[model samples]
Target: MSTQYTFEAIGTHWQIDIKDAITKEQSGELYEQIIKRIALFDAHYSRFRADSLVSTIARAPGSYQLPDDAEPMLSLYHKLYRMTDGRFTPLIGQALSDAGYDAHYSLKEKKLSPPPPWDEALIYNYPTLITQLPVLLDVGAAGKGYLIDIVGELLEHAGIRNYTVDAGGDMRHRTTAHMPLRVGLENPADTTQVIGIVDLQNQSLCGSAGNRRQWGNFHHILDPRSLTSPTHIAALWAVADTTLLADALSTCLFFVPPETLLKHYAFEYLILQSDFTVIMSPHFPARLFTVK
Candidate 1:
Protein backbone atom coordinates (compact mmCIF):
# COMPACT_ATOMS: atom_id res chain seq x y z
CA MET A 1 0.00 0.00 0.00
CA SER A 2 1.16 3.52 -0.81
CA THR A 3 1.49 6.25 1.81
CA GLN A 4 0.50 9.80 0.94
CA TYR A 5 0.82 13.23 2.55
CA THR A 6 -0.36 16.69 1.52
CA PHE A 7 0.71 20.16 2.64
CA GLU A 8 0.58 23.77 1.45
CA ALA A 9 3.67 25.67 0.34
CA ILE A 10 4.91 28.00 -2.37
CA GLY A 11 1.35 29.35 -2.68
CA THR A 12 0.25 25.93 -3.88
CA HIS A 13 -0.62 22.49 -2.57
CA TRP A 14 2.09 19.79 -2.60
CA GLN A 15 1.53 16.07 -2.41
CA ILE A 16 4.03 13.27 -1.81
CA ASP A 17 3.36 9.59 -2.35
CA ILE A 18 5.55 6.73 -1.31
CA LYS A 19 4.85 3.56 -3.27
CA ASP A 20 6.36 1.30 -0.66
CA ALA A 21 4.79 0.40 2.63
CA ILE A 22 5.82 2.90 5.28
CA THR A 23 4.77 3.66 8.83
CA LYS A 24 2.55 6.64 9.57
CA GLU A 25 5.28 7.93 11.88
CA GLN A 26 7.82 7.69 9.09
CA SER A 27 5.53 9.50 6.71
CA GLY A 28 4.92 12.27 9.24
CA GLU A 29 8.62 12.78 9.84
CA LEU A 30 9.34 12.90 6.11
CA TYR A 31 6.47 15.33 5.53
CA GLU A 32 7.78 17.67 8.24
CA GLN A 33 11.26 17.70 6.74
CA ILE A 34 9.87 18.40 3.26
CA ILE A 35 7.71 21.24 4.54
CA LYS A 36 10.64 22.74 6.41
CA ARG A 37 12.81 22.68 3.29
CA ILE A 38 10.02 24.26 1.23
CA ALA A 39 9.65 27.03 3.81
CA LEU A 40 13.36 27.77 3.61
CA PHE A 41 13.13 28.04 -0.18
CA ASP A 42 10.17 30.40 0.08
CA ALA A 43 11.94 32.56 2.68
CA HIS A 44 14.84 32.96 0.26
CA TYR A 45 13.28 32.89 -3.21
CA SER A 46 9.66 34.04 -3.00
CA ARG A 47 9.05 37.50 -4.45
CA PHE A 48 5.80 37.65 -2.49
CA ARG A 49 7.73 37.81 0.78
CA ALA A 50 9.23 41.19 1.56
CA ASP A 51 12.01 39.53 3.55
CA SER A 52 12.92 37.08 0.79
CA LEU A 53 16.39 37.17 -0.73
CA VAL A 54 14.95 38.04 -4.14
CA SER A 55 13.03 40.92 -2.57
CA THR A 56 16.16 42.21 -0.82
CA ILE A 57 18.15 42.08 -4.05
CA ALA A 58 15.33 43.81 -5.87
CA ARG A 59 15.29 46.61 -3.33
CA ALA A 60 19.03 47.12 -3.36
CA PRO A 61 21.30 48.45 -6.09
CA GLY A 62 24.73 47.34 -7.30
CA SER A 63 26.15 43.87 -6.75
CA TYR A 64 24.75 41.31 -4.32
CA GLN A 65 26.32 37.98 -3.39
CA LEU A 66 23.94 35.10 -3.89
CA PRO A 67 23.69 32.24 -1.46
CA ASP A 68 25.68 29.06 -2.17
CA ASP A 69 22.48 27.18 -2.98
CA ALA A 70 21.53 29.67 -5.68
CA GLU A 71 24.11 28.38 -8.19
CA PRO A 72 21.87 25.78 -9.85
CA MET A 73 18.99 28.22 -10.31
CA LEU A 74 21.23 31.07 -11.45
CA SER A 75 23.17 28.89 -13.86
CA LEU A 76 19.97 27.59 -15.44
CA TYR A 77 18.55 31.10 -15.66
CA HIS A 78 21.66 32.36 -17.37
CA LYS A 79 21.60 29.55 -19.91
CA LEU A 80 17.89 30.10 -20.60
CA TYR A 81 18.38 33.83 -20.83
CA ARG A 82 20.88 33.30 -23.61
CA MET A 83 18.96 30.51 -25.34
CA THR A 84 15.58 32.28 -25.48
CA ASP A 85 17.14 35.54 -26.66
CA GLY A 86 15.69 37.47 -23.69
CA ARG A 87 12.23 35.94 -23.85
CA PHE A 88 12.64 34.01 -20.59
CA THR A 89 13.87 36.59 -18.10
CA PRO A 90 14.09 36.91 -14.33
CA LEU A 91 14.24 40.67 -14.87
CA ILE A 92 10.49 40.83 -15.53
CA GLY A 93 9.56 41.26 -11.87
CA GLN A 94 8.84 44.97 -12.29
CA ALA A 95 6.67 44.29 -15.30
CA LEU A 96 4.84 41.59 -13.37
CA SER A 97 4.36 43.89 -10.38
CA ASP A 98 3.07 46.68 -12.59
CA ALA A 99 0.53 44.21 -13.99
CA GLY A 100 -0.65 43.67 -10.36
CA TYR A 101 1.09 40.37 -9.47
CA ASP A 102 3.13 42.14 -6.86
CA ALA A 103 4.55 41.30 -3.44
CA HIS A 104 1.06 41.34 -1.91
CA TYR A 105 -0.34 38.73 -4.35
CA SER A 106 -3.29 40.99 -5.08
CA LEU A 107 -4.54 41.33 -8.67
CA LYS A 108 -5.11 45.02 -9.23
CA GLU A 109 -4.90 45.98 -12.89
CA LYS A 110 -2.39 48.71 -13.64
CA LYS A 111 -0.65 50.19 -16.66
CA LEU A 112 1.86 47.71 -17.94
CA SER A 113 5.50 48.61 -17.66
CA PRO A 114 8.33 47.34 -19.84
CA PRO A 115 10.70 44.85 -18.33
CA PRO A 116 14.24 45.88 -17.56
CA PRO A 117 16.58 45.72 -20.50
CA TRP A 118 18.41 42.40 -20.21
CA ASP A 119 21.75 43.75 -21.43
CA GLU A 120 21.89 46.79 -19.15
CA ALA A 121 19.98 45.88 -15.98
CA LEU A 122 21.18 42.44 -14.98
CA ILE A 123 24.50 40.65 -14.64
CA TYR A 124 25.41 37.37 -12.97
CA ASN A 125 28.63 35.59 -12.01
CA TYR A 126 27.46 32.26 -10.58
CA PRO A 127 27.34 33.04 -6.83
CA THR A 128 27.07 36.78 -7.35
CA LEU A 129 24.18 38.61 -8.99
CA ILE A 130 24.83 42.23 -9.96
CA THR A 131 21.99 44.56 -10.80
CA GLN A 132 22.84 47.93 -12.33
CA LEU A 133 19.24 49.11 -12.10
CA PRO A 134 16.50 48.69 -9.53
CA VAL A 135 14.71 45.65 -10.83
CA LEU A 136 12.63 42.95 -9.17
CA LEU A 137 13.96 39.49 -10.06
CA ASP A 138 11.14 37.00 -10.43
CA VAL A 139 12.16 33.33 -10.82
CA GLY A 140 8.70 31.86 -10.40
CA ALA A 141 8.86 30.04 -13.73
CA ALA A 142 11.83 27.83 -12.96
CA GLY A 143 12.20 28.20 -9.20
CA LYS A 144 9.39 25.81 -8.34
CA GLY A 145 10.90 23.12 -10.55
CA TYR A 146 14.26 23.57 -8.87
CA LEU A 147 12.55 23.22 -5.51
CA ILE A 148 10.92 19.98 -6.64
CA ASP A 149 14.31 18.65 -7.74
CA ILE A 150 15.75 19.52 -4.33
CA VAL A 151 12.93 17.67 -2.55
CA GLY A 152 13.45 14.68 -4.82
CA GLU A 153 17.12 14.68 -3.85
CA LEU A 154 16.10 14.78 -0.22
CA LEU A 155 13.89 11.74 -0.73
CA GLU A 156 16.70 9.91 -2.51
CA HIS A 157 19.06 10.68 0.33
CA ALA A 158 16.55 9.14 2.73
CA GLY A 159 16.68 5.78 0.86
CA ILE A 160 13.19 6.20 -0.51
CA ARG A 161 13.47 4.82 -4.03
CA ASN A 162 9.86 4.86 -5.13
CA TYR A 163 8.01 8.11 -4.65
CA THR A 164 6.31 11.01 -6.36
CA VAL A 165 6.52 14.71 -5.52
CA ASP A 166 3.75 16.83 -6.94
CA ALA A 167 3.56 20.62 -6.53
CA GLY A 168 0.36 21.89 -8.08
CA GLY A 169 0.53 20.80 -11.76
CA ASP A 170 4.30 20.23 -11.80
CA MET A 171 5.29 16.66 -10.90
CA ARG A 172 8.39 14.49 -10.51
CA HIS A 173 8.07 10.76 -10.13
CA ARG A 174 10.43 7.82 -9.67
CA THR A 175 9.16 4.35 -8.99
CA THR A 176 9.98 0.70 -9.41
CA ALA A 177 6.34 0.03 -10.10
CA HIS A 178 5.65 -1.56 -13.47
CA MET A 179 2.83 0.74 -14.48
CA PRO A 180 3.49 4.32 -15.54
CA LEU A 181 1.65 7.14 -13.76
CA ARG A 182 -1.20 8.88 -15.53
CA VAL A 183 -1.31 12.69 -15.34
CA GLY A 184 -4.24 14.73 -16.59
CA LEU A 185 -3.94 17.86 -18.69
CA GLU A 186 -6.45 20.58 -17.93
CA ASN A 187 -8.28 22.32 -20.75
CA PRO A 188 -7.69 26.07 -20.91
CA ALA A 189 -11.29 26.70 -21.88
CA ASP A 190 -12.68 24.66 -18.97
CA THR A 191 -10.56 23.98 -15.91
CA THR A 192 -12.89 21.20 -14.83
CA GLN A 193 -12.23 19.09 -17.90
CA VAL A 194 -9.16 16.96 -18.50
CA ILE A 195 -8.21 17.28 -22.13
CA GLY A 196 -5.78 14.36 -22.06
CA ILE A 197 -3.45 12.23 -19.97
CA VAL A 198 0.30 11.54 -20.08
CA ASP A 199 2.00 8.32 -19.07
CA LEU A 200 5.09 9.12 -17.10
CA GLN A 201 7.80 7.14 -15.34
CA ASN A 202 11.02 8.29 -13.75
CA GLN A 203 10.50 11.72 -15.32
CA SER A 204 9.26 15.25 -14.62
CA LEU A 205 6.37 17.17 -16.21
CA CYS A 206 5.52 20.87 -16.05
CA GLY A 207 2.40 22.55 -17.40
CA SER A 208 1.75 26.25 -18.06
CA ALA A 209 -1.48 27.86 -19.22
CA GLY A 210 -1.91 31.51 -20.21
CA ASN A 211 -5.40 31.53 -18.75
CA ARG A 212 -4.25 30.19 -15.38
CA ARG A 213 -3.77 33.70 -14.01
CA GLN A 214 -5.31 36.66 -15.81
CA TRP A 215 -6.60 40.15 -15.16
CA GLY A 216 -8.13 42.36 -17.85
CA ASN A 217 -6.10 41.68 -21.00
CA PHE A 218 -2.96 40.60 -19.13
CA HIS A 219 -1.93 37.17 -17.95
CA HIS A 220 0.94 35.72 -15.95
CA ILE A 221 3.08 34.69 -18.92
CA LEU A 222 4.20 37.89 -20.67
CA ASP A 223 6.17 38.44 -23.84
CA PRO A 224 9.12 40.61 -22.88
CA ARG A 225 9.41 41.98 -26.41
CA SER A 226 5.80 43.13 -26.75
CA LEU A 227 5.20 43.83 -23.04
CA THR A 228 1.96 41.86 -23.42
CA SER A 229 0.63 38.39 -22.83
CA PRO A 230 1.12 35.89 -25.65
CA THR A 231 -2.07 35.10 -27.52
CA HIS A 232 -0.81 32.38 -29.88
CA ILE A 233 -0.87 29.48 -27.45
CA ALA A 234 -3.34 28.84 -24.68
CA ALA A 235 -1.40 26.15 -22.79
CA LEU A 236 1.75 24.03 -23.00
CA TRP A 237 3.32 21.01 -21.27
CA ALA A 238 6.81 19.54 -21.38
CA VAL A 239 8.35 16.38 -19.99
CA ALA A 240 12.03 16.32 -19.16
CA ASP A 241 14.64 14.47 -17.14
CA THR A 242 14.39 17.03 -14.33
CA THR A 243 11.61 19.23 -13.05
CA LEU A 244 13.72 22.35 -13.47
CA LEU A 245 14.21 21.74 -17.18
CA ALA A 246 10.59 20.78 -17.66
CA ASP A 247 9.33 23.86 -15.84
CA ALA A 248 11.57 26.26 -17.73
CA LEU A 249 10.84 24.61 -21.07
CA SER A 250 7.08 24.73 -20.55
CA THR A 251 7.33 28.51 -20.49
CA CYS A 252 9.92 28.55 -23.24
CA LEU A 253 7.54 26.67 -25.53
CA PHE A 254 5.46 29.84 -25.75
CA PHE A 255 8.26 31.90 -27.27
CA VAL A 256 10.47 29.24 -28.89
CA PRO A 257 9.56 26.49 -31.28
CA PRO A 258 10.27 22.81 -30.57
CA GLU A 259 12.70 22.53 -33.48
CA THR A 260 14.70 25.51 -32.30
CA LEU A 261 14.54 24.48 -28.64
CA LEU A 262 15.59 20.89 -29.31
CA LYS A 263 18.90 22.14 -30.69
CA HIS A 264 20.00 22.94 -27.14
CA TYR A 265 17.78 20.72 -24.98
CA ALA A 266 15.90 17.45 -25.19
CA PHE A 267 12.27 17.13 -24.10
CA GLU A 268 8.81 16.02 -25.28
CA TYR A 269 6.08 18.64 -25.56
CA LEU A 270 2.38 19.18 -26.27
CA ILE A 271 0.84 22.55 -26.89
CA LEU A 272 -2.80 23.68 -27.17
CA GLN A 273 -3.18 26.60 -29.55
CA SER A 274 -5.57 29.52 -29.15
CA ASP A 275 -7.78 28.01 -31.84
CA PHE A 276 -8.06 24.76 -29.78
CA THR A 277 -5.69 22.83 -32.05
CA VAL A 278 -3.35 20.47 -30.21
CA ILE A 279 0.22 20.03 -31.40
CA MET A 280 2.79 17.56 -30.05
CA SER A 281 6.39 16.77 -30.71
CA PRO A 282 7.09 13.51 -32.56
CA HIS A 283 8.28 11.81 -29.40
CA PHE A 284 5.75 13.30 -27.02
CA PRO A 285 4.65 10.24 -25.07
CA ALA A 286 1.05 11.18 -24.33
CA ARG A 287 -2.44 10.43 -25.54
CA LEU A 288 -4.16 13.71 -26.38
CA PHE A 289 -7.92 13.79 -26.70
CA THR A 290 -9.06 15.89 -29.63
CA VAL A 291 -11.45 18.77 -28.98
CA LYS A 292 -14.59 17.91 -30.89
Candidate 2:
Protein backbone atom coordinates (compact mmCIF):
# COMPACT_ATOMS: atom_id res chain seq x y z
CA MET A 1 0.00 0.00 0.00
CA SER A 2 1.19 3.54 -0.82
CA THR A 3 0.01 7.07 -0.10
CA GLN A 4 0.89 9.79 -2.58
CA TYR A 5 0.89 13.56 -2.25
CA THR A 6 1.27 15.89 -5.22
CA PHE A 7 1.54 19.66 -5.52
CA GLU A 8 3.27 22.45 -7.38
CA ALA A 9 5.94 24.43 -5.62
CA ILE A 10 9.16 26.29 -6.29
CA GLY A 11 8.22 26.68 -9.97
CA THR A 12 7.88 22.91 -10.45
CA HIS A 13 5.79 19.87 -9.61
CA TRP A 14 6.51 17.64 -6.63
CA GLN A 15 5.25 14.14 -5.86
CA ILE A 16 6.02 12.21 -2.68
CA ASP A 17 5.10 8.56 -2.19
CA ILE A 18 5.28 6.44 0.93
CA LYS A 19 5.27 2.71 0.30
CA ASP A 20 4.06 2.02 3.80
CA ALA A 21 0.55 3.02 4.74
CA ILE A 22 -0.06 5.71 7.38
CA THR A 23 -3.08 7.34 8.99
CA LYS A 24 -4.81 10.18 7.13
CA GLU A 25 -3.84 12.54 9.93
CA GLN A 26 -0.21 11.51 9.63
CA SER A 27 -0.31 12.13 5.89
CA GLY A 28 -1.76 15.56 6.37
CA GLU A 29 0.89 16.55 8.90
CA LEU A 30 3.73 15.32 6.69
CA TYR A 31 2.35 17.15 3.69
CA GLU A 32 2.14 20.40 5.68
CA GLN A 33 5.69 20.02 6.93
CA ILE A 34 7.00 19.35 3.40
CA ILE A 35 5.19 22.36 1.97
CA LYS A 36 6.55 24.68 4.63
CA ARG A 37 10.10 23.46 4.13
CA ILE A 38 9.95 23.88 0.35
CA ALA A 39 8.47 27.37 0.76
CA LEU A 40 11.31 28.39 3.05
CA PHE A 41 13.90 27.25 0.52
CA ASP A 42 12.24 29.07 -2.37
CA ALA A 43 11.96 32.27 -0.35
CA HIS A 44 15.74 32.36 -0.11
CA TYR A 45 16.99 30.82 -3.37
CA SER A 46 14.56 31.72 -6.14
CA ARG A 47 15.80 34.42 -8.46
CA PHE A 48 12.38 34.54 -10.11
CA ARG A 49 10.81 35.77 -6.90
CA ALA A 50 11.18 39.54 -6.54
CA ASP A 51 11.22 39.28 -2.75
CA SER A 52 13.70 36.41 -2.63
CA LEU A 53 17.12 36.71 -1.03
CA VAL A 54 18.66 36.15 -4.48
CA SER A 55 16.91 39.28 -5.74
CA THR A 56 18.16 41.21 -2.71
CA ILE A 57 21.70 40.07 -3.47
CA ALA A 58 21.28 41.08 -7.08
CA ARG A 59 20.27 44.56 -5.99
CA ALA A 60 23.42 45.11 -3.99
CA PRO A 61 26.80 43.78 -3.04
CA GLY A 62 27.09 42.99 0.62
CA SER A 63 27.32 40.31 3.26
CA TYR A 64 24.04 38.49 3.75
CA GLN A 65 23.08 35.82 6.25
CA LEU A 66 21.29 32.86 4.73
CA PRO A 67 19.16 30.11 6.20
CA ASP A 68 20.88 27.74 8.63
CA ASP A 69 20.68 24.93 6.06
CA ALA A 70 22.15 27.07 3.27
CA GLU A 71 25.66 25.86 3.92
CA PRO A 72 25.43 22.55 2.02
CA MET A 73 24.10 24.09 -1.18
CA LEU A 74 26.54 27.00 -1.08
CA SER A 75 29.46 24.74 -0.33
CA LEU A 76 28.59 22.44 -3.23
CA TYR A 77 28.37 25.43 -5.57
CA HIS A 78 31.74 26.67 -4.41
CA LYS A 79 33.36 23.32 -5.10
CA LEU A 80 31.75 22.80 -8.53
CA TYR A 81 32.58 26.39 -9.51
CA ARG A 82 36.25 25.72 -8.95
CA MET A 83 36.19 22.26 -10.50
CA THR A 84 34.55 23.41 -13.72
CA ASP A 85 36.85 26.46 -14.06
CA GLY A 86 33.89 28.80 -13.48
CA ARG A 87 31.70 27.09 -16.05
CA PHE A 88 29.24 25.63 -13.56
CA THR A 89 28.48 28.63 -11.37
CA PRO A 90 25.75 30.15 -9.28
CA LEU A 91 26.91 33.50 -10.66
CA ILE A 92 25.23 32.67 -13.99
CA GLY A 93 21.90 33.98 -12.65
CA GLN A 94 22.33 37.35 -14.32
CA ALA A 95 23.65 35.79 -17.48
CA LEU A 96 20.52 33.68 -17.58
CA SER A 97 18.40 36.79 -17.21
CA ASP A 98 20.40 38.64 -19.85
CA ALA A 99 19.67 35.81 -22.28
CA GLY A 100 15.93 36.27 -21.58
CA TYR A 101 15.30 33.77 -18.78
CA ASP A 102 14.52 36.54 -16.35
CA ALA A 103 11.94 36.75 -13.58
CA HIS A 104 9.17 37.41 -16.09
CA TYR A 105 9.92 34.47 -18.42
CA SER A 106 10.06 36.99 -21.23
CA LEU A 107 12.08 34.52 -23.34
CA LYS A 108 13.38 37.46 -25.32
CA GLU A 109 16.96 37.42 -26.49
CA LYS A 110 19.28 40.25 -25.52
CA LYS A 111 22.97 41.13 -25.56
CA LEU A 112 24.69 38.82 -23.13
CA SER A 113 27.91 38.64 -21.14
CA PRO A 114 29.59 35.82 -19.29
CA PRO A 115 29.24 35.62 -15.54
CA PRO A 116 32.08 36.81 -13.36
CA PRO A 117 34.41 34.36 -11.73
CA TRP A 118 33.32 32.92 -8.41
CA ASP A 119 36.11 34.63 -6.47
CA GLU A 120 35.30 37.92 -8.17
CA ALA A 121 31.57 37.53 -7.76
CA LEU A 122 31.11 36.30 -4.19
CA ILE A 123 32.61 34.49 -1.26
CA TYR A 124 30.66 31.71 0.42
CA ASN A 125 31.61 30.88 3.98
CA TYR A 126 29.05 28.67 5.62
CA PRO A 127 26.15 30.66 7.17
CA THR A 128 27.36 33.89 5.58
CA LEU A 129 27.70 34.58 1.87
CA ILE A 130 29.48 37.77 0.85
CA THR A 131 28.76 39.21 -2.56
CA GLN A 132 31.64 41.12 -4.07
CA LEU A 133 29.32 42.48 -6.73
CA PRO A 134 25.60 42.74 -7.15
CA VAL A 135 25.08 39.43 -8.98
CA LEU A 136 21.98 37.31 -9.49
CA LEU A 137 22.67 33.84 -8.15
CA ASP A 138 20.85 30.87 -9.67
CA VAL A 139 20.97 27.38 -8.24
CA GLY A 140 18.48 25.72 -10.57
CA ALA A 141 21.08 23.06 -11.16
CA ALA A 142 21.01 21.50 -7.72
CA GLY A 143 18.70 23.33 -5.32
CA LYS A 144 15.77 21.06 -6.11
CA GLY A 145 17.82 17.96 -5.47
CA TYR A 146 19.08 19.26 -2.15
CA LEU A 147 15.50 19.98 -1.17
CA ILE A 148 14.53 16.45 -2.17
CA ASP A 149 17.22 15.12 0.14
CA ILE A 150 15.89 17.30 2.94
CA VAL A 151 12.36 16.01 2.43
CA GLY A 152 13.67 12.47 2.38
CA GLU A 153 15.36 13.13 5.68
CA LEU A 154 12.10 14.46 7.03
CA LEU A 155 10.34 11.22 6.06
CA GLU A 156 13.08 9.08 7.56
CA HIS A 157 12.94 11.01 10.78
CA ALA A 158 9.24 10.27 10.88
CA GLY A 159 10.15 6.54 10.92
CA ILE A 160 9.10 5.97 7.34
CA ARG A 161 11.68 3.69 5.74
CA ASN A 162 10.21 3.12 2.28
CA TYR A 163 9.43 6.23 0.27
CA THR A 164 10.29 8.33 -2.75
CA VAL A 165 10.54 12.11 -2.92
CA ASP A 166 10.49 13.33 -6.48
CA ALA A 167 10.61 16.93 -7.64
CA GLY A 168 9.87 17.31 -11.32
CA GLY A 169 11.82 14.25 -12.55
CA ASP A 170 14.79 14.25 -10.20
CA MET A 171 14.11 11.98 -7.22
CA ARG A 172 15.37 10.10 -4.18
CA HIS A 173 14.15 6.61 -3.36
CA ARG A 174 14.59 4.32 -0.39
CA THR A 175 13.03 0.92 0.26
CA THR A 176 13.76 -1.45 3.10
CA ALA A 177 12.16 -4.34 1.20
CA HIS A 178 15.04 -4.04 -1.32
CA MET A 179 12.58 -3.98 -4.20
CA PRO A 180 14.03 -1.73 -6.87
CA LEU A 181 11.92 1.01 -8.44
CA ARG A 182 12.04 0.86 -12.21
CA VAL A 183 12.24 4.35 -13.72
CA GLY A 184 11.97 5.26 -17.37
CA LEU A 185 14.50 7.70 -18.82
CA GLU A 186 12.65 10.24 -20.88
CA ASN A 187 13.89 10.89 -24.38
CA PRO A 188 14.80 14.54 -24.66
CA ALA A 189 13.69 14.93 -28.27
CA ASP A 190 10.45 12.99 -27.76
CA THR A 191 8.83 13.36 -24.38
CA THR A 192 6.24 10.70 -25.19
CA GLN A 193 8.90 8.03 -25.39
CA VAL A 194 11.60 6.74 -23.05
CA ILE A 195 15.08 5.83 -24.31
CA GLY A 196 16.06 3.71 -21.35
CA ILE A 197 15.10 2.21 -18.01
CA VAL A 198 16.89 1.95 -14.66
CA ASP A 199 16.11 0.08 -11.49
CA LEU A 200 16.62 2.70 -8.84
CA GLN A 201 16.97 1.38 -5.31
CA ASN A 202 18.32 3.19 -2.27
CA GLN A 203 19.79 5.95 -4.39
CA SER A 204 19.05 9.07 -6.37
CA LEU A 205 18.99 9.71 -10.13
CA CYS A 206 18.96 13.08 -11.90
CA GLY A 207 18.89 14.03 -15.56
CA SER A 208 19.42 17.27 -17.57
CA ALA A 209 18.72 18.26 -21.12
CA GLY A 210 18.38 21.43 -23.16
CA ASN A 211 14.90 20.63 -24.43
CA ARG A 212 13.28 21.19 -21.03
CA ARG A 213 13.53 25.01 -21.11
CA GLN A 214 14.52 26.70 -24.33
CA TRP A 215 14.40 30.21 -25.71
CA GLY A 216 16.29 31.66 -28.67
CA ASN A 217 18.84 28.87 -29.00
CA PHE A 218 19.44 28.66 -25.25
CA HIS A 219 18.29 26.33 -22.54
CA HIS A 220 18.59 26.52 -18.78
CA ILE A 221 22.12 25.05 -18.81
CA LEU A 222 24.42 27.88 -19.86
CA ASP A 223 28.17 27.87 -20.21
CA PRO A 224 29.46 30.67 -17.98
CA ARG A 225 32.52 31.41 -20.12
CA SER A 226 30.85 31.27 -23.54
CA LEU A 227 27.51 32.60 -22.34
CA THR A 228 25.84 29.89 -24.47
CA SER A 229 24.46 26.44 -23.98
CA PRO A 230 26.41 23.40 -25.12
CA THR A 231 24.95 21.92 -28.27
CA HIS A 232 26.98 18.75 -28.45
CA ILE A 233 25.10 16.91 -25.72
CA ALA A 234 21.43 16.06 -26.06
CA ALA A 235 20.84 14.67 -22.57
CA LEU A 236 22.63 13.33 -19.52
CA TRP A 237 21.90 11.52 -16.24
CA ALA A 238 23.78 10.72 -13.04
CA VAL A 239 23.14 8.36 -10.16
CA ALA A 240 24.64 8.82 -6.72
CA ASP A 241 24.10 8.12 -3.05
CA THR A 242 22.71 11.62 -2.55
CA THR A 243 20.38 13.61 -4.76
CA LEU A 244 22.45 16.76 -4.25
CA LEU A 245 25.49 15.16 -5.88
CA ALA A 246 23.47 13.48 -8.57
CA ASP A 247 21.69 16.69 -9.52
CA ALA A 248 24.79 18.88 -9.55
CA LEU A 249 26.81 16.34 -11.49
CA SER A 250 24.14 16.01 -14.17
CA THR A 251 24.65 19.69 -14.98
CA CYS A 252 28.36 19.54 -14.49
CA LEU A 253 28.66 16.73 -17.04
CA PHE A 254 27.40 19.11 -19.70
CA PHE A 255 30.43 21.38 -19.17
CA VAL A 256 33.02 18.79 -18.27
CA PRO A 257 33.84 15.19 -19.15
CA PRO A 258 32.61 12.30 -17.03
CA GLU A 259 36.24 11.38 -16.30
CA THR A 260 36.97 14.90 -15.04
CA LEU A 261 34.26 14.55 -12.39
CA LEU A 262 34.60 10.81 -11.86
CA LYS A 263 38.08 11.38 -10.41
CA HIS A 264 36.56 13.36 -7.55
CA TYR A 265 33.09 11.90 -7.16
CA ALA A 266 31.68 8.39 -6.95
CA PHE A 267 28.77 8.25 -9.38
CA GLU A 268 27.44 6.50 -12.51
CA TYR A 269 26.41 8.47 -15.59
CA LEU A 270 25.09 8.28 -19.14
CA ILE A 271 25.52 11.00 -21.77
CA LEU A 272 23.59 11.06 -25.03
CA GLN A 273 25.13 13.18 -27.75
CA SER A 274 23.36 15.27 -30.34
CA ASP A 275 24.03 12.58 -32.95
CA PHE A 276 22.73 9.84 -30.64
CA THR A 277 26.17 8.60 -29.68
CA VAL A 278 26.09 7.22 -26.15
CA ILE A 279 28.90 7.65 -23.63
CA MET A 280 28.28 5.96 -20.34
CA SER A 281 29.95 4.32 -17.39
CA PRO A 282 30.07 0.57 -17.44
CA HIS A 283 28.59 0.47 -13.97
CA PHE A 284 25.60 2.61 -14.87
CA PRO A 285 22.57 0.54 -13.97
CA ALA A 286 20.43 1.18 -17.01
CA ARG A 287 19.38 -0.40 -20.32
CA LEU A 288 19.12 1.86 -23.33
CA PHE A 289 16.83 1.20 -26.26
CA THR A 290 19.29 2.92 -28.56
CA VAL A 291 22.09 0.60 -27.51
CA LYS A 292 22.02 -2.62 -29.49
Pick the lDDT winner.
Answer: 2
**What's the lDDT for residue 40 in model 2?**
90
Count of clashing residue pairs in every prediction:
0, 0
Alpha-carbon runs more than 4 Å astray in model 2: none
Report, for every candidate in turn, its global Cα lDDT versus the true structure: 0.86, 0.91
List the RMSD of every prediction in angstroms.
1.5, 1.0
**lDDT of prediction 1:** 0.86
The lowest-lDDT stretch of 10 consecutive residues in candidate 2 is 117-126
TM-score, per-candidate, Cα-based: 0.95, 0.98
Tell me the tens digit of each residue's lDDT in model 1 across 72-98: 887887788888888898988888888
Candidate 1 residue 204 Cα shift, in angstroms, is: 0.6
> Quick one: best TM-score, which candidate?
2
